[model samples]
Every structure is written in C-alpha cells, then in structure tokens.
Target: MRAATGLWRWRHNPLRRTTDLAEAWIAFAAAALLCVVVPLTGWAAGSSAHGSLQRAVRTQQEQRVPTTARVVRQADGPGSGPRTADTAGEERLRRSVVARWTAPDGSVRTGTVTTSRRQSAPGDTFPLWTDRSGHPVTPPMRAGTARAHALIAGLMAAMLTGLLVEIVRRLAVRRLVLTRYARLDRAWAATGPDWGRTGTGS
Candidate 1:
C-alpha cells in the first residue's frame, strides 16, 4: 500500500513527465534491491565470519595445549601483588611477571604473563596459553565471541549494500535531471527568437 502510494505519479498520473516516471521507477527498483540484497549480503558475511571463527576455535583447541608457567622473575615495580592505596602496610603488586612454560614440542618458552596471584614468588605457577609453535598466545575464540563478531560483520555488510544501492539511485536521478534540463534548454532556444515571425506561417 505504501509503495503504491509512493509511486502514484508513475502509476496513474496523466500530467507526469517522462523524467518523473523514470525517476520513480529507478527509486522503486532501488528500494526493492536494497530490501533484498542487503539482508542476503549481511547473511553471507555473517555466515562466513561465523564459520571462519568456528574453524579457528577448533584448530586452536585441537593443536594448542594448556600448561602452567613458572615465574622466573618478578615484573618491574614494587611487590608482585595487587595495587593498593594505603602505603603503610600495603604494597603495589605487578600482576604481570616473567615466566617460562613448556611448549607442545617440549621446548621451554618464556614471556611476561599477567596473573591474578598476589605476591607470587619465583617458581610460582600461573596458567597460560600457547600456540602450536610453542609461542605464548591469547586464549582461543569462544562460540559467543564468534557470534558477536559475526553480528558486527553482518551490520557492516548491510550498511555497505544499502549505501551502494543508494549511490546507484542517486546517479540515475542525476542523469534524468540533466537530460530534462538539456531538453528544456533546446526547446527554449528553438522558440526564443521565432515568436515575432508568426505571420510568415511557412
């Protein structure tokens, strides 16, 4: 109903110009494409993202192994404890510490790791993640995280699809407007100097 009302000029208007009908059709078609293509594009993007992230999660879980990191040295600053306000008995702790852990290949890997343990001393153990190459890395992607990423990708795809459709509509309208102006100019030029010679009907 709303679409019909919007295109009424092109549907049943006797006074509508050719340019008006063309513009109306272009707008209508663009609107339709935007409604359909945008969602499909969004779905494709989201599905691809979800699938890729899921694969990454699987690979990470399969190849990577979890192990404990042994603290080799305390991180920079005061006590390796949580930050505190009172300086009397309270001490600043560095959550991050230099630690070493055995890699999947039995090689030892050492790096700074952030932990929640307070005042942890040398040889203290902390949980950490490592990749197949034995390099320390962040945790693997979770299903919820993948879904969130897919949502963001879907929104971006939808926006880009709509933007492209609008550009096409704008270009079509601009061409029609320019063509109409040119025709009007040519008609004015043909009759501008011939009005006074009406007596010479030839």
Candidate 2:
C-alpha cells in the first residue's frame, strides 16, 4: 500500500524526477514478486522433492526383507556398545546383539543388530530387517517422514528466493539513489556561479 501511495504521488507531480518513478516502480515490482513468485517456487520445489522421496520409499520397501533372527550371543565390541543414536527413537535405547537368520536365498547370515529385549539370551528371537543379500539395513522411510522432508525443502527454497529478491531490490534502489545524487550535484554545480546573484536582481 505504501508503494502504491508513493507511485500515485509521483505519477503526475511536476517535481517528480525520473529516479523517483523508477524507485517507486522497483518497490512495486518487488512486492508483486514476493506475493506471487515466492509461493509458486516453494510449491514446485516441495512437489518435486515429494515425488523423489516417495519413489525412494517404494524402492526400499521392495528391496528390503523382514525376518526373525535368533540371538546367538550379546555383542561385545567397539561398535556394539549401545545404540545411542538411531533413526527410530525407541531403537536408540535397545542393546546390540549378535543374531543369526536365514537369507532370502536360504543361506544362514549372522550380524549384530539391536534388540529391545533386556535379558536377551541365546535362541531368543527379535524382528530384523535385511536386504536380499542378508546384510542388515534400516527400515524403509515412512510416508510421514518423506512428507516432512519435502516440507522442509520447500520452506528453505522459499526463504532463499525471498532473500535473493530482497537483495536485488536493495541493490537496484541503491544504484538509483546514487544516480539521483550525482544528477543533483551536477545541477547544483551548473548554478553555483549565479546562486548568490539571483536574489540581487542580477
């Protein structure tokens, strides 16, 4: 609204200079882009990210297999201390155990995997996820998680677009202001010799 007011005030005023109109137009253009382009960019980015992430989710579901592993013994090694960090919050609290399971190819596989059982002993069982080759892998991404990632990507893209627009607007305005100042200086210099005599009827 302020930009509109400035534009209207400068539209036909006798004192309006070229720089004044240009500055007003720049402000209006910037406002328009912020209102229209920013949201569109965000939506496009989010949609693209959603499609890619969903495809990955589907691929993981197809390639991974779930099976029950019989615990062979408690895992004791450098990497088997404790699951302090995991994608699934509850899994982070689980203890690592060496377990054996049959692969999709019917071959026996053994690996260290996390289990929720507190007093796990040999022959005890826990659910596990592995690839067809029998290597342990993280579970597939959930739909909700994919959506969350897409949303974050969209927000970041929108913020970056806004910042770039703002920077361009500021630079253009600064250039216009500098040009206006230079013109003023030239006009003043041209009239300097007669500035004092104008009031003396010379």
Candidate 3:
C-alpha cells in the first residue's frame, strides 16, 4: 500500500537508498500487474473450460438417452469405467448394478448400469443412460456440471497467476538488492583500504 501511494518519492527523506526506490516502484508495478493479470488469466481459463464442457455436454446429450431399467440382480460396478475429476482433481467412483431395459428398438437389453444406491433389489426400477447401441453408459453431462468445471478452472488459473506474481516480485527485489550490494562492494574496494594510507594526497 505504501508503494501504491508513492511514499518513496518524497525527496526530503534522508534514509532512502536507491534500492528502496527501485523496490517501491517494482512493488507498485507488481500490484498493478496482479490486478490485471489475475482476472484475465481466470477469465481465459474459465471461458475455455466453459466452451469445452458445453461442447461435451451437447455431444453427450446428442449421443445418449435417459431411460429406466430394472435391476436384474445385485452386482458390482465395473472397476474400469470412464474417470471424471472434480475441481480438486479427485477421481469420483461410480457404483452400479445389473439391470435390464427396453431400448429404442423396443427390444429388452440387459447390462450393468451406474446407480446411486449402495444396495438395490432385483426388479427394482432405476434410472440409466444408454448409448446408440442401447448399452448402459454414463449419464449425459449437464450445464450445471459444466459451469462448475469452468469455475474450478478459473479459480486454479487465478491462484497460479498470484503465485507467478509473487515469484516475479521476489526475483525483482532480489535483483535490486544484489545490484546495490555489488555497487557498495565496488565503492569500498576503490576507497576503503586507501582512506588512511594517504600516500597520494590528504
């Protein structure tokens, strides 16, 4: 905040180093950049995710259908179905049961389907999704889920932007400090040892 207000520009101050002014300016620049870059990064990431997810939702809706199926028997879900990640990048496991359903062709088909219930009884009706081949598959993605994915992407992008900004700020400050120290070292090398020796002149 002090840097944002240009306090280091007060020329009357006797305690200021060139490095101090340089760091102050750098701080101001870093703050300004953070304000702009963070939001821009988030928007870009969110928009890209939104577009991709929206497309996925449309595709799934186009190629799939929601239907009801009767549980043929209690069964274990496939251990290897498609894996989807949440915002935290955790894999969500799907539960399932053996079920039978009538397809678009009016023929009865039997297959394993994802289910929400931990225990299901045979002949109990449950919701399921079917692909073009009438085989049970994952449900179609919804717009709400797509929006959630976009939000997560945006937040992650914003956090990464903040991290980058901090790293750059630290590097800038370190560079200025090193430069100041080098200048001091050079000045001392030229004058420190010869101060009292006096050989040349007083």
lDDT of 2 by residue, 1-202 (tens): 7888999999999999999999999999999889999999999999999999999999999999988899999888412322334635765466778889888899998877877787789999977878878787777789899999999999989899999999999999999999999998999999988987887887
lDDT of each: 0.78, 0.86, 0.80
Candidate 1 structure, TM-score to reference:
0.75
Better of 2 and 3 by TM-score: 2
Worst 10 residues of 1 by lDDT: 79-88
Candidate 3: stretches off by over 4 Å: 7-18, 76-96, 194-202
For model 2, state the Cα shift of residue 72 in Å: 1.7
Over the stretch 25-103, how does candidate 3's per-residue lDDT look in tens digits?
Answer: 8888888878898999999999999999999999999999888989888666552234455311322334567788888
Q: Clashes in each model (backbone N, CA, C under 3 Å)?
A: 1, 0, 0
lDDT comparing candidate 1 with the true structure: 0.78
Query: Considering every candidate listed, which one attains the maximal TM-score?
Result: 2
TM-score, structure 2 vs. true: 0.85
Clashing residue pairs in candidate 3 (N, C-alpha, C atoms within 3 angstroms): none
Ranking of all candidate structures by their lDDT, best first: 2, 3, 1
